[model samples]
Target: MTSLPPQEFTSVARAEAPLDENRGFACHVLIIGGGASGTLMALHLLNASPDMRVTVIEKSALLGCGIAYSTTDPGHLLNTRVHNMSAYPDRPEHFRDWLRQSGMAPGATDESFVGRQIYGRYLNDLIARERDLPEVSRLRCVKDECLRLEETPKAVIAHLGDGTCIRGDRAILATGHAVPVQSHAVLTSGWDFTPPADPGQPVVIIGTGLSMIDHLITLLRNGHRGTITCVSRRGLLPQVHTETKPLAISRGHVPLGAPVSAILHWMRGLAADAERQGGTWRDAVDGIRAHVSAIWRAWPEAERRRFLRHAASFWEVHRHRVPPDSARWLQEARDRGQLRILRGRFEEATMGEDGLIAVRIRTSGGERVLPAGRAVDCRGIRRDPAKDSAPVIQDLLARGQSRLDPLKLGIDTNEWAQVLLADGRPSRRLFAIGPCARGAAWEITAIPDIRVQCAELARHLHAIEAQDPVGVSRG
Candidate 1:
């Protein structure tokens, strides 16, 4: 694959030409959110179909970073290894190669983890190269939030917050992860608890997931010496990535249609077997990672739900391993007695007499009242249109343009990611990718997964565009 050139930001006035009276709509594709997933989809579509016109709408002023990569803090690092961070699976070493060529690193296979900001820069460069294509005469990017989406028999119309509408043959919703949930007590306090500046105050994190780890990193980097508490029902921190040698496990080790109890027994038996053979359970879990999706798919919905209710937390902790460096930092923080991880449930919260936020937590033992000078919730929020704050998603849900998944995981979609309607039919011109497609494919959030979806969606869109002779002719 060719490396993308540097991006040049120009105003819409300078880059876009006046729309011709005969040219009915704006572009062929109108991608919402110019983050990693959105830009990758655009790049794939343009490369696959050179004559296609693409336009990306980003609510933030910057593109390619979105919320995840928008952080300016040097402490925020990529959790995955550098080897698996490539945007393209075919070009397995693309990211490592880019890091070496861009002077971000000295070698391709260096074990050192790179900062998130550098990844943002690399994404921007990729977008720039796609924009510079010759066959792609129009690659307009608008800096406006989409407030509403109107689905017509012909095309999907996107209404911008600034009173502008753009129509496209197809729309791809790559709106990345939503903001972390904020505890009601913290919100009622009206306190500005931005990290680094207000590090003296004790804060309680809601979830002990990866997002919590990110917030913890920020708090530590900002020189906040105060006590930090992380609370969760399970209080399970992500597992640390190990460098143990690989071990092989056979496919038929566990039989299908086994009950949860039976499966747990089998897993335990396998662990004991491995240990007796001078191998650790980590090897078994690593082997399971290679076949997790298959296992997940094979299990019935009831079994999946049972796992979610019973063993999801523990499974997640083991599945989502943190980088070695991050694990070291977390370990040091714990050794220093600055960070506390508690397993409990949040009962209620109120403002204390000292003008701080007081939270009542119910743990396995009993109840305890804790006070924090300030608090920010790090429990990542789900993107459900019925419950999301975004006007666009709310409007779409209200107008029957989209439907929520039965489990409320995200928006409902068909296998191809075509947004499903309340009538249980797929929309021809509307599709969703990335986290929004969690309802269809449970494993659609990560970069590698989203990249593959983008390529597949691009191919599907290209086939549709080809079917419309008039649309192709106009373009």
Candidate 2:
């Protein structure tokens, strides 16, 4: 068997094939988001079934550039390498191959860390090519927002903001990472960066994670000479992506359903052992990425909460890493006394009599007030999705159609990506994938996990339709 890149798959290689659409329901799938998740779902559905139609409605103009990949910065390289960033799980080298064929990165290799903007272009081109294909005629890309969704006995109707209602056999919630709006920090948009009126004035950023790094890079690129202060609870920065030797971790090696404490001990021991073998702790961290979801699901609610409270931050810093160049630049900024990280949590911000902004932080010493000319909330992905989810998600929750996860990470869903209702019934009509299903699978937020989830859910829907045609709207 051919060896897959580190982030592509788990222990063993398995074969996948499209189901016989001749025996399946020739239905339509309405996806609310047209980012990577939605595009991947549509592709898989079209490939797996012959007659199924997929209409992808994205509020943004682009098809596959979600909040994460929409950035146009050349300096912002993908955290993961080319080999692991493919939109297809089975086609491990698809992205690498695309890079070479498209001349986007003619010399790109499996280890090449290409610019995110180029990757965004790659996704856009990928979907664009698919849509133009006669075989993929079932794929429809709509530029609109689904404001409300209504499920009928025979169909699902999506009401768009433009006064257009789309009726399909089934609806999917692929709306990725919705950051709850209102930022008292005054700088809400991470991707859209406007040069500060006074570049020399001190700037305060709210989080010390990847988002923070993104803003920092933008600031430096734009020649901002001001001192930057990044605030977070522990002020932990993400590690940098590095070359990793394969670590063969068997499925049985993971302590499934065990206490979070035991899991933590195992990870520490694993990292220690890897270091002893001349490999970095990163080997141990990357080794467990595929199994985190299973371990997350196996834990009791109490144990899950305990992990979140105690070890989640450390895990995240090691797990979700930055590009090597970004890490090096960050180090240089720190060395020059231009960037400093504050160990505290952002509480409030207020406008002073002067034009400056006073940002308040709750620290161990006491409540400290930091005055700055500008402030931004780089709080990263773990935002309050319950309050600021998509318009359709909010409507669903208000109408008791769907419920939030116990931890409020995102909407609650079952293992098969079926949306769980308030009454705890699985929603055969509505399904969620990608970040929205983070509560169900913690790793689904990344491309590797998301591609697999999309593939599985597409197969699952086809299989279900084969048994019972008419699919979700049969009610």
Per-model RMSD to reference: 4.9, 6.9
Candidate 1 lands at a TM-score of: 0.86
Write one digit per residue (lDDT tens) for candidate 2, span 1-475: 1211223211111221221122233787889898878878887888788768777888877777787777757777788988899988888799999889977788999998888777766777777776777543566677778999888767788898988788777888999887767666455555556668899999998889888888898889889999999999999999988888756788898899989889998999999989999999999988888889999999988998999899988998999899788998899999999999999978888878888889999999999999888888777665788777898998999999999899988989988788888999887788999997788877788888888888898888888887776554332
Q: Provide the global lDDT of candidate 1 against the true structure.
A: 0.70
lDDT (10s digit) by residue, model 1, range 165-202 = 88777778878765533447354221122563456778
Candidate 2 Cα outliers beyond 4 Å, as residue runs:
1-25, 134-136, 183-187, 472-475
Pairs that collide, model 1: none
Which residue pairs of candidate 2 clash?
none
Candidate models: Cα lDDT each: 0.70, 0.81
